[model samples]
Target: MVFIQKGNNPLLAVKAFVQGIGLLGNPKLRKFVLIPVLINFLVYGVAFALGYLYLADIIDQFIPGWLQWLRWILWPLFFISFFIAGFFTFTVLANLIAAPFYGMLSAAALALLSGESATITEAPWPKVIKAELNRAAYLGSRAIPLVILSIIPGINVLAPVLWALFGAWGMALEYLAYPLENAGILFSEQRKLIGGVRWGALSFGGLAAAGLALPLINIIVAPAAVIAATIYVREIETDNAR
Candidate 1:
């Protein structure tokens, strides 16, 4: 009975995310959710360990000797920037690896929400791979500029905030792509549809991004996000049909 009325309500995104988490306990979705959770657990564990070990060294290389005095201020900013960047970078990699499983999960979730049969055909892998590459390219085109900005002294102050916002948007688009793609929505059309409901997308993405940063909770966030995105997209399509 988890449902959302379609509109621009940003809060709808929050509700959808919660509903997704709730739905995880449903007997119907548990199987679909398991593999993605395992994938995320492995990816997240490695990313966290690597970040803990090498992130400071990476940050040091970015700051020049003359900027040593600014370490107190810059350290925090760079840490936030790197953390966000690294998180999303690894997230993209994880998603690429899990795309097929995610497609099946999306299909099942979509079927559940739409009250249709849960059985799904094997996802078209070629289309799924193409869609993932398109998303990676789209995110990279923007990420490069943000990475460049994060190293510049004066302007770098804004890098953390900017990176955070971009991360949220990218995540929203990333998760939404699965269900949309399953529905045979093209990448271009997906962007347009998400753009039409930007606020809700951002909020949902922001919450998901924030959740992923948490330790134990992050293991489940990916699959939940997939479900949430499915719910969000389903509601939007329903509204359009009205």
Candidate 2:
């Protein structure tokens, strides 16, 4: 079935991304993706530091006259922020860490399913995997600078949209590259394939964010997002090839 329908359902798209990650292998590749993802961690760390230094006092001022009651309310809010932030920080980190392995695994799985094992054995495992990961990382990392820039005066207002779109594109790149590689397609080909079903992918990508959205489920969000992406990629390949 063509899972990437013309309709734009954000939840479905995210669900698909989570499914994609389940198809992944290679512990080493997962570790490799972590390096770039740590860059994101560092960025978030700076945000935390700044918030503590500059915003904590401002938050205290808003606590009102009921110090006892106010403390209870503000305490939860403060803790929640840390929890939510850490959750998303790591989910993105996982995607950044797992892209290369996902790419190779996607290619291998599709090739085997396509009755092309003979040729699959000749696949350039290292070159293709690394290239795909690098491209995905490049696209994913585009959001980092935007995030930093968003803190600037005028640009801070635009942060939400820019961050969301950058995030969507990053998810699209990382998720789509695997199936494209599995089918022996290049980055350009993968882009075209995803472009054809852009809305669907975006929808799924958004849904994948839900796991990262809530603090409790965030623990599973990273692997879940990867699995969803794998499923979506496989569906896209199956639909187009048929």
Candidate 3:
């Protein structure tokens, strides 16, 4: 089973992502995102209709006859706005619903390594906040470098691999570190604690990201990825102890 595969293998990262979707295996989060997205769509639709009505007379008078050609632009922009609003609403709700499961799965992943998962129970909020902060810091630090790397001559050739590799590393660290730190382990200490297991976590995250990128199938990938990471981390800790 993919679940039992060595977590450190980068080649397996994509599979891990696909497999994570299976683990989440639930329709609940889907409904959660859908409901909010629907509401946003309706709200935006109403606002658009009302605004158009209120502005109908003023628009006809102010807008030049030839400027009416801008209807092409306005129509697309209007729909695009609705699409964005729906997507944003869905994304916010998805994150909130997925956070708890992500936390638990992250904890479980660490537990596989025989690292204590207690912080999930003992100090949930602080650990969650710390993970979020670290993630923000990690991404912020890499932003400029990533932008520069994208512009390089030959380096551009290696961009995809680098993207996959770095993406996996960041995600792994974010998902796995929370549970470890919550157990009273300091953030710096995690560098050493997760030393050999970093590749494994990266592999899992890479695969998870791949799954998230898939068409239609991506809806459940978020939570599934979290659970798989949790499992992978837990297994790594177990093997490390032996």
Candidate 4:
């Protein structure tokens, strides 16, 4: 977890950005990233298959006939929409599936952030899996509104903004789960602690959200976020200890 000095939102964001990219140097981090990468592939696979079907439905049912003539326009727009839809829609989906497996990754990242070697637990595999899925779902469920908003018309334009805003907020809490959970902080306490430097936390999240909304780079968003969130929270605690 990385925290910037007070009022240094820019550095907070920059550190997170650098930390995520800097993760490439740690071969250990690569192992953690691959599981989520596989999850992204799996989630996007289903979304891709349904991509056309969802697009046609959105244009035909949600879109007005006046816009029908603009299939070329609508096609590309909806394609982008699919990406947005993919962002919110598949994020939770991906988290639910990957969270269990990624918990150790999250924990490892947290240990790495603190300059400590990650240690394995004696806990059984099934229990660990169950705990991770539950943690991911606890956070993922909160984003249901974002998922719904993505499908709704008129207000859908606002979805991107909401995605950028709340998406950052959500990712902060969601990805920070491992470290926070390790510290025995629940969602409510997590929010309160994060609220101390709200802008900084959101800035951290907003950066990840920006990458998430983009093509190609979007796939790395989750793993990157988990790593980023670990650095972020740990930094904040480190600063406070001074």
Candidate 5:
């Protein structure tokens, strides 16, 4: 394992993300990544099929016949809204379902990074599920206000900027939770640690979010993000220990 020296660089997150992409070819980590990829593929396949089949009907229901002309204007906006909502919703659902595997993946990645033998342990499923639910609730509480802001007349202009920032921050917290939780760090403590290096965390997650929004590429992003997050958390710990 090659370790990058710690520094006060703002681009550390970018480096970590690139390194993480490189690490995906590792035989040791491939199995851990496989399951999540398969899950994503299956979930997304069904979602796309369903959306294609009913999207027209769904739009028609929302827009009355008198307002049919508005479809041209609202169609693009509807697609954007659906894509954003579906991405976040399915990401959360997929992670929740695969939480245990992610926990193991995080542990293995940490071990590999530390140049120690990879020890795959059975995660405490109940605890893992509970932790995932907690994160969902945390994201939901904040997202509700953002959703409302996005609907307002004038103030809504700033909502996109706020949502982008929040999405990046949320992505950081979401992935970082895996490794930190495996190390027995509490959720609150994980936030504080990531908050200490907010810029790097956001950069890492922003890239992850971008990858996730792309078609086909998103299948690999989940596991890569997990590994990248493991790397990020390790760096954070090393820096703080100094």
Candidate 6:
């Protein structure tokens, strides 16, 4: 991961995501990345099942009889809309499930950045889990309003954009937490670092935002996003150094 850009370039920020995918070539990174990927897979597998088996049926109930004439057009659009909306819903929920492990993953990703072997010292699970749960709760609470708006007919129209932007911002915050935390940077400082290169942050977020909307890709996106965000942070620091 060469420093792709010195300044906050939106396109470079977006490219950071691609760089993340490239980083998986490390092979060792794959071992650690799988933890989050599998966790997300199992949780989302059940979610996909439930959505396929029940959610659509429930949503179909909301379609009025008068709209039956437009079933072909409306149903596809609705399902597609729901699929995209599910990206945010599922990403938020999956992150909550995997939060306990993210710090470890983020730390590992950071280590990998240094060309160091990602030998993670086992953390105290109880304490770590508690902290993660609290963090997830905070993030969850922030996400709830957007999740609710996604279901309401009038407001759901805006749900995609709102949820995408919100989810991406959360991605920036969550993935960067471990590396930044390690550096003794607090949230205020984290915000400043990210805010300085706002477009870079959003571009990183945007790729993540788009990834969440994808199908199979969504499964692997979180860890990749974390790795990408780590690289992004390092690039910021490197750029500052120069």
Best candidate, lDDT: 1
Candidate 4, residue 29: how far the Cα is off, in Å: 2.7
Q: Which stretches of candidate 2 lie over 4 Å from their true place?
A: 1-93, 103-125, 213-216
Model 5's TM-score against the true structure:
0.85
Candidate 5 residue-wise lDDT, 1-242, digit = tens: 11233422558777777878888889888888889889988877766777778766664564556766866865555455445655777778888988888888888888889999966987889999999998899988988987666544345556556767877888888898898888788788877777766777788778887888777898888888899888876886676676
Q: Note the clash tally of each candidate.
A: 0, 26, 15, 8, 0, 0
> What global local distance difference test value does model 5 have?
0.77
Per-residue lDDT of model 1, residues 3-81, tens digit only: 2345468878888899999899787889888988899989999999999999999998888899899999998898899
Clashing pairs in 6: none
- Which candidate number has the best TM-score? 1
lDDT of all the models against the reference?
A: 0.86, 0.53, 0.49, 0.66, 0.77, 0.68
Model 6, residue 32: distance off in Å is 1.2
The deviation in Å at residue 149 for candidate 3 is 2.4
Candidate 6 lDDT at 118 equals 59
In candidate 6 the C-alpha lDDT for residue 194 amounts to: 67
Query: What would the per-residue lDDT of candidate 2 be over residues 74-184, giving only the tens digit for each residue?
Result: 544543343333434554555454545445444444554345653323345566556656664666466567645543433444555555665566556655565556556
- Candidate 5 error regions (>4 Å): 1-10, 54-75, 152-157
Question: Lowest-lDDT window of 10 residues in candidate 6?
Answer: 1-10
TM-score of candidate 6 to 2 decimals: 0.76
Residues 22-126, candidate 6, lDDT per residue (tens digit)? 876567677777778898888778777878788678668766888778666556556655665566567667876676566666677788778787567655667
Candidate 1, residue 179: lDDT: 84
Q: How far is 56's C-alpha from truth in model 5 (Å)?
A: 6.1
Count of backbone collisions in candidate 4: 8
lDDT of 3 by residue, 23-120 (tens): 44333334323433344344445544655575445334433566567655443433333332333233333434345445554554444335343343
The residue-level lDDT of candidate 5 at 196 comes to 68
